[model samples]
Target: MRTHNTIPAFGLGTFRLKDQVVIDSVKTGLELGYRAIDTAQIYGNEAEVGQAIAESGVARQDLFITTKIWTDNYAQDKLVPSLKDSLAKLRTDQVDLTLIHWPSPGNAVPVAQFMGALAEAKAQGLTKRIGVSNFNIALMKEAIAAVGAEAIATNQIELSPFLQNRKVVDFAKSQGIHITSYMTLAYGKALQDPVIGAIAKAHDATPAQVILAWAMQLGYAVIPSSTKRENLASNLLAQQLQLSDADMAQIAALERNGRLVNPDGLAPAWD
Candidate 1:
């Protein structure tokens, strides 16, 4: 699914946080050695994320920044321009990765149109890589057909112990597309599971660490977000936690098709 692991296995995600909260979170994550920062147009915090990165004094070359284009920007005419706006808000000339935030609702914009525009964005130096988010198996196939597998860097989706999304995962892996697991902790839901709790207790690790390690161990990239400095610091350390085969199998059984990010009108018919 990856060649040289272009996407970082762990990073910071900015979703609901805004203003000083997001600014502080990005700054804190950077101070804790986080290099990859994920944001989206709908997140409404790109400017603040840019502010934090600029203030952190971290060299631009050392960071991997990603932002997604909203569904409204899926149109061929709008996609590249929308990404240019994102670059301006991000205070950078180009983003390391840019994704189609979601499949066009009701096929309002065809995949080929937007994917071609995204390819243009890359060709014009607007982004280093291009991909999609919240895409199901069928949508992924359309994207691959539109841009070819090698052009699609990743398919960021809502995945966790609860919603293993094996159908989508298996298909993506088969197609050689990387899966970026957003809300990989299931928005903190899996942290409360007794199964995960037991594993964390056994390893003397936090439930978040156990979940993150489990995903990375399976070769999925995770972007878990936190606002508190302590939480952010501790979450970054999950990269070090390793779970045994028994632990992995235990968590795999935790799947129950639980998905947390599906939205009305915006979500596609999932795989």
Candidate 2:
């Protein structure tokens, strides 16, 4: 079952993956049935992702490609052009979705300014959808004020079993903005939890599968990346893993505000 309408419930994420390593990951993922590929300018792997896609023999129309604009390009003058550069690198004329990589550092760029530029990028057909990432409740309000909630496709965040992010999740739900849960595995930390292990054992699934299923069951889109083919295939199989209500509650109790993606200057004051 897909989440967020057009967005796939499960996708391949490419963060901290670079060069041939990223290239191989994406190619293998596409072969393994991953249709959505997430990359960011900051990830420095868009071109590699594009290459893998171009070489994978999968038609462009069959794939859903997403890329994020880095903070340095938040300026109105730079947003669209930067996206165009990303498109060129991705070997596509338009991406399925594009996002603000992060909020303007210390409000260096106003919400309306960069968001308007992103909307214009959509208007010009540079991307089919536009959204934001790592935005807090206040920032989401500003984005909605700038482009209306209907225009923002999603708010991708560092969501995992250990960092449930209920406050941000609730706010996004109230406004009808979809949530995209990045790092749903908490960098593999949740896989080691005894509670998750018990649940996985009960279902005959991996801990990663349990966590990904939990997120998807909550109606959030997830993009979990892996360099190994076995892990990639297993993660995709997570779409079929169903957790019992008891299993859900057990995982819910594991939330202890564990966040692994916070960068000093680049991250915003989270919700």
Candidate 3:
């Protein structure tokens, strides 16, 4: 198993991608040396991601795969079984990490119930680590109470230059939970910002690279996705694009509480 105190700092995010497109993206990512892959049942492309992994011949030991359990399957009776289904679709016996996709709709399911099931799944070797996504400060506290902070590997959330989410980030950090940034580029919204664009020009990097670098520099693991091979290849180089403190502060100033992925029922009251 890929053992680490924190989630991988960078990975390939498979959100809103499916069928041949996701398959191709994963395949290209593997070919380009990406070992960590992130997917969720709600994304509907676990099977394709598995197909690419299996066909790529990458040894299971070398890959770190993460999948999220949808809120619909949060019940104790359904959690582990749904995870096993995800494993089957991903062509893997276990996932490196598993997260609760979102809090149960209207708190229909108690946090302790599903978290207990998730812990059971980890104990049973279905997932090496357990975490939660889209969780705000209050929800994070509840999750920690359910399983203890030690069991939570990361709190994956929507964080980017446009939506810094420092309050949530600070809380997770205080609880010793690593933060993973999904949609770190703000769905290409940050790419057009003059601040990010200028930083990119200053460093001879793409706007996407500037934003990804900015997030990583702040210690949040980032999973930025792309369908094109060139974008995928170039984006990985963000790891090497270090930003100065001034550059980072400039990006921080761009935060306007601009959250883009909050679904009406799916998102909780963010901090």
lDDT (tens digit, per residue) of candidate 3 on 1-271: 2255567889999999999999999999999999999999999999999999999989999999999999899999999999999999999899999999998999999999999999999999999999999999999999999899989999999998888898999999998899999989888988999988999999999999999999889988989898999999999999999999999999989989999998999899888
Against the reference, the lDDT scores of all candidates come to: 0.91, 0.92, 0.92
Candidate 1 lDDT, 47-126, residue by residue in tens: 99999999999999999999999988888888888888999999999999999998888999999999999999999999
Alpha-carbon deviation at 239 in model 3, angstroms: 0.6
Show model 2 residue runs off by greater than 4 Å: 1-5
TM-score of each: 0.98, 0.97, 0.98
Candidate 1, residue 106: lDDT: 90
**Backbone clashes counted, model 1:** 0
Task: State in Å the error of residue 8, model 2.
Answer: 1.0
For candidate 2, lDDT tens digit of each residue in 1-271?
A: 2243357778899999999999999999999989999999999888999999999999999999999999999998999999999999999999999999898988999999999999999999999888999999999999999999888889999999899999999999888888999989888888999999999999999999999999999989999999999999999999999888899998889899999999988888888
Which 10 successive residues of model 2 have the least lDDT summed? 1-10
| Count of backbone clashes, every candidate in sequence | 0, 0, 0
Q: Kindly report which residue stretches of model 3 are placed more than 4 angstroms away from their true locations once superposed.
A: 1-4
